[model samples]
Target: MATNSTVSLSMKFDRTSILGSGGYGVVFRGEWNNKIVAVKRIEKTNCENNKGEDALQKLHHPNVVKLYHVDSDIDFRYYALELCQLSLNQLFNGDEAQKNYQEKMPPEKEVCLQLAKGLAYIHEKGFIYWDIKPQNVFISVHPTDVENVSMKWADFGLGSPLNDRGSFSTTEHNTRPDNWLAPEILQMKENFNRTTPLRQEGTVKSDVFSAGLIFGFYLLKGRHPYGSQFNIPANIVNNTPVNLKAIEEKKHPMHAIIMDMLKKNPNDRISAADVITRIANIQ
Candidate 1:
């Protein structure tokens, strides 16, 4: 069990600091039992998982951060998780370091190698990490003398159950962060009505497709081959499928491997082994 200094109801955990935030919830650095911990609390009136406490308990991995315990929304409750100092987002986005990420890019081949290792680990267990954005990956729960470029998949809030095709469940989030989402996620756009049933079911290939996108981001200076923040590039919107369109237009030699992974047809997206094999060649 991880540490949790109890914070009473009607008492807001002293928000010493804020970690990172996303659509699911915001994270804060708090003190409990006189010790530091990360408190993540999600509020959804119809949220079946509430604070995701149960799902957090089931995931145990060396690279994945540990969840101490949860303080449910039973009474304006908050979840208490292991409080780590920084996320890849912070390390890469902070003032002193922001320039580093902006100017000096890390070896794309090396980072892809590391991701391959993590992806392989999760896939072997029949699990698909539906979300694999840089924000969801973290390093060093605590530091050691030696330098280790180790990273673990941290957020399982969107974890998918393998071998359970017959089962389906509905959780909120009628909308998601579209930047990192794969093409299929927008499956029901053809329907003008928002209430129409949209198939958001995740598949292993979807994970692979997302991996290709991340690889594209890394190799292309954080550029989403599909065109992102600035505009969804002209070439991408013309005829080619959104996911593979930008990748296809690139004349870069290395992009060939990445293009294959970005295939719009999820069934054609590269597998975990294919990613490992192709990514290993970048060096």
Candidate 2:
């Protein structure tokens, strides 16, 4: 019978190659106990005073990446995780094989359904997945069927637990990437007032906005809903509406649902549960 394995300095694995790198740390493909796995190496300084490790340890959904083990030395922390074949970003913009595979991508409804299920589980567990871009969504082959693939949410480093009011502060990370930010968050930054409570800067709706952007990008073939303007961030900050006419003409069935998720007013945006229901209906 096959069983899960763990790794450590004493039980070391060979780092075959680097999978990717970002502000957080580097991910590498590794071989452990004769099985391939992903090894994430994060500097101790980068992970200090953060709840990411705790968050990943507690998360156990099929639609979320599985953490096999964690080990650390004086300088760095390492996470042994299930190896995913590709990220949604890679499928859209990676090498020739990855690009070619996009043509065979799952339907948008199915993709969103998986994402919404993951988000629902996260929200139910009292964490807000602040990051929901394509790069954070991974594609993996089914354990029993080599021909089947599924999407799993990855990279929970930026996730935060909901506060007393079911919201989280975005003040500490002021320079977050603007492309995926919700309008309210941008507005809060623009109209910064010391008297205003920092916790009000973000809510569950902010995540919905980011997820909507991912769906729109997928439907539009990697283009931002606002098109390729140099001032895209500024436009997003100002709550410039995304024109959905093109997607509607393309007969993308989720156009209405995407627009609902992208509402300028956080109060107007649809909840992750609602998104799941809507997508399930379509499917």
Candidate 3:
């Protein structure tokens, strides 16, 4: 029902309560026409190009947050999304609910299952989400019933749609994401020069690395991949052999397959299909 209004300047409401902040923009929960909406006001400098608007509009999936409309004028750029209400990250990582006090939270198995289904749909559409952190997963109540809620992915800033062959590579961002980046992305040799192709900077495998890290983060209770003893910065700089030897002390059922996906060798990593198959079989 929410469509972009080309002439309605009044719909641009000022809702300043901060939802989140990042390198590009600040998200806020605001109201327009008695409806609650979350607005992302990206800097005009970025909006001048307008891929953000096109990206949000192109997304067509139930598991992805829907774009209500966009309001961009000479003064500012506003991207209005259906407010998520809350995110899975805040529920698990915040307060004593799931972090401290040992407060019981939702079934981890169920959450993981939902995560896989959403991912399957995304991959089916030839899209790869570069960032898969918990902070990007949101929970929103059903429009008719506030008590019923659903999980959805948020943030499309760094995400990219796969090309016809389902591949894109990059090498510009060699700085390892430490616990999250896959080994090939962290170590694979690439030809870098002034005229080097852009795809070489990142790849489908890079996304796989990030995906493995999210599942690992889930199984590890939001701790760094390695605890305190290991030096991650050292591993990043030297391009030497690094292992989860630190977190190895703990045994998680998801460890084996996930680590396969995170393998330093891109060819050894599991595909997203394998991830879905594993998710389906997990008890």
Candidate 4:
């Protein structure tokens, strides 16, 4: 059932546990209407007329996280969202000691296909998922069948429309491991003497680049395409090329598609639609 936008505080729900906390806000697990839900509480200052809610309102895709309700009064804003079992980051870096059971990683092809479909849909909707990392990719848990598990794109705090140029700043730190930012975004931080205006925020191709890195991480069992020994930001600024031969050796079938997505030049990168087609062909 669709959640009413005007739900009052009197609504019966139990806050189960804190899901996660970040610079933007805190996410909590809650039981509402006999269903598990994720409730994100953001300060009024951080909520820009509920932009995140507006972005997610019309979106309905299997690979996209569902937003059930948005409620606000004066000082605080709340978003009630669909609850997922695990994030791709959690699955990538499993803690057997804590969880008791060992984490089983999904097939690279399966992960790639789902992610591509989600990204393609976002692009088609004229929005850019500026942040596309394992942490933002969530997986639905199924007790009986691992293959039945599915992935969905979550966390729209950094998302913006394609034409929204002010979403990103050129002076900010660009290449943190947690960010998984594209080379173009990293380059914006560099002092380049360019004749034309540089793009401060991410474009569709920028999202594609991040998607490639995520795909590489999955193929290499959570290891980034660029080795951990070097600073990723420095490598990106220095125009260090990805080692395609090594990637091909690791996952031959996805080599071409991933390579195209990782192209340094955004104009030269393949479209999300093209990526979907390529993935479909391989499947």
Candidate 5:
């Protein structure tokens, strides 16, 4: 198990150190044992269904964020985690790092493989990372090799366990960005309003869809496979075809795997593990 030093040590944080904030909590940059760390302060009420802390405690992987400690007070729960340099969203879209990311873009196969490995590990542990967007994907630069950077999956607040039927159901429609969500999720939300029976439940494959889009966005240099921001949700729901011509022209090996992952039907999508397998020979 990872160390839990929060109880024995006194750590301080404030709003000024916030790195990001979401519906669940705000993450602050702080120091622990002379090492920089991220402290997530989430209100207790908002964490009733959050599986992030518990899941992080059990999941230790190169591609998964490390949890250093957990602490709680009368009103909020605090999590001490490894501090990453920047999020995928910041690296890809932020003004400060845009030029840097473009100049030193990590090899496509390596990044895709690492991300798929993380998702596969989560699935192997019987959990689904319901949110797999650029914001939740973090990047860390190598201490010795600047050219060698690593990526990891973070923020598991929206995650859930896969039941005996290999799926889970939720009524929360506003938990994720519609453009980044799986088609089945959007369909369920639409059906719920009409009191129609759900045809498909959330599953690991749904996560695959989101992950596929992220990988495509990264490989395509910020172009979404599903068209523009306003059109993504509709395109996904309508099963609109994706245009990967830029990558296809370059003969990118992961192109086919990404296509399989973005299939509208959850059943048609490839498993995270299979994604790793398909890319194993890339290098």
Candidate 6:
């Protein structure tokens, strides 16, 4: 385990080998214990108020990105994680998006199953991954066969453990509205003001909805289920009807399963475990 402080602190990462950067933090391509890895560097201030490190240390699942080590200095905290070259979003919008899609890297069913398994594991461990989007789903591709890719959940900065009641509340943090955000979360954005601040309780079911949207996006070939780009957040917040006719019309095997996951009410959505079971039955 990465929890061993001595092993974690001894690891070294190249400052110039940045793989990605965003509001959350910067990820650097690095090596640990003779294996290639990604070193995620975040400010100590963030981790001080975050449970991501705690959650990552306890979660050990094949479907989740493996944390090899944890290192830190005066200003920042560094986490060495399994290196994944591509994200689910990259398959649809990267410069090589069209090429990747043509190659059909990792078939649709496999991707969905892998995602479900990862989320199921996270929930089983009593955590709510508030950030469940295509960008957070990392993919490791084979050098020869793109179809032989592996998917894993990565970036647990917004993740937190569920309370005794099976839910967690966020008073104010890094959460933001996005295309894949669940309706309940989007609704929070509506009431979020400078004075009132942002207070919301999130459950595993919210993750189920976001996961369903990701499946829909992949199956729909990058199209969002909630109308178009401009109105997506609003539509979700308003609980507007989802446009699933494309899958429904084609009678896609996962159509009904996804439909239930996207239900307006959180209680109506199926569990991540149920998703795995349903997918298994179809196969």
The deviation in Å at residue 239 for candidate 6 is 3.7
What digit string (tens of lDDT, one per residue) describes model 6 on residues 45-72?
A: 7678658888888899988998888878
lDDT per residue for candidate 1 within 89-199, as digits (tens), equals 545555674435333323556666666666766666666676667677665523463234455566636655465762223334455555566666545333334555455
* Residue range with the least summed lDDT across 10 consecutive positions in model 4: 166-175
Q: In candidate 2, residue 138 scores what lDDT?
A: 92
Candidate 3, residue 275: Cα displacement in angstroms equals 1.2
Using TM-score as the measure, what is the rank order of every candidate, best first?
6, 5, 2, 4, 3, 1
The models' CA-based lDDT, in order, is 0.57, 0.77, 0.60, 0.71, 0.80, 0.80
- How many clashes (backbone N, Cα, C below 3 Å) per candidate? 2, 0, 10, 0, 0, 0
Which residue pairs does candidate 4 place in steric collision?
none
- Writing each residue's lDDT as its tens digit, candidate 5 over 1-283 gives 1333443445555557778998788898876667678888888887776577767888889999988877777777888788888888887677766437655557778888889999999999998888778889998777678887788999747667788899976654355677888998888677564344444468999999999988988887777878887888888899874657677788888888888998988898999999999989775
What tens-digit string does per-residue lDDT give for candidate 2 at 89-199? 888789988777676567778878888898888888998888777788898876787557778988746777888998886545453566777888767666665445444
What lDDT is obtained when candidate 6 is compared to the true structure?
A: 0.80
Model 5 residue 188 CA deviation (Å) reads 0.6
| Candidate 3 whole-model C-alpha lDDT, 0 to 1 | 0.60
- Candidate 4, 55-108: lDDT as tens digits: 788678998999887767676677778887777677658565323212544566
Q: Candidate 2 or 5, higher TM-score?
A: 5
Candidate 5, backbone clash total: 0
TM-score of 3: 0.73
Best by lDDT: 6
Range of the 10 consecutive residues with the lowest summed lDDT in candidate 2: 1-10
